[model samples]
Target: MEQYKRKIALTNARFYAYHGYYHEEQMLGNEFFLDIICFVSNPTLNTDDNLVKTINYEELYRIAKEEMAQPKKLLETVVDNILNSIKVNFHEVNEIEVSLRKSNPPFGGDAATAEVSLYWQSGT
Candidate 1:
């Protein structure tokens, strides 16, 4: 007997939205990058080339976009929302990893970006 696994990923998704704690930050808006990876238990479903067997990238993008559109003071909150949405909607996903980056953050120095990463697994 053998076990099979599959991973689907969406990387470098860019969005400009109002997500910050400062008043100026919200008003000014900023660019954000999102990366997501979903793990599946059945690898054969991927080989079958069936849409129903795999997570839809478009749907995943839409979920992320919708969540990002909402203004949240913390990037961690945004990541949590996205992660929960994916897990609820796509039960086939056994594990998920999310990375979010805010570019050119207003640190008033030479900071390029600020990022946060989150991982979630079912039943844990």
Candidate 2:
């Protein structure tokens, strides 16, 4: 199963979201970077010229957009939504890894950003 699986990376996919532990953050909103790696159980993607043989990137983007539109207090929640959305939408997807970074977090510190990452499989 591992050998036949393929990884598709979506890097620095940007979105504007109202997700934070603070009230100001929810009001002002912020820029978010999402990186996703989808493990598809299709070796044919390596050789098949047709995109139909692999997961569609457009559909993935739509899923991300919809998930981000809903506000959440924690990045973990967002990651969960993304993973579950993908798993539910695409049956061929066996596993997923999602990283969400909030640029310029509200924390009054020298840190540039705060981020959370989650890895999920279809089943235990």
Which prediction has the highest TM-score against the true structure?
1
Q: Write the per-residue lDDT of candidate 1 for residues 1-124, one digit (tens) a residue.
A: 8777788889999999999989888999999999999998855545666798778989999999999999999999999999999999998899999999999889875759899999988783
TM-score of 2: 0.88
lDDT of 1: 0.91
Worst 10 residues of 2 by lDDT: 40-49
lDDT of 1 at 60: 93
lDDT of 2 by residue, 45-91 (tens): 44658888888888888889999999999989999999888888888
Model 1 weakest lDDT span, ten residues long = 41-50
Off by over 4 Å in 2: 45-48
Give the TM-scores of the predictions, in the order they appear: 0.93, 0.88
lDDT of 2 at 40: 71
Off by over 4 Å in 1: none
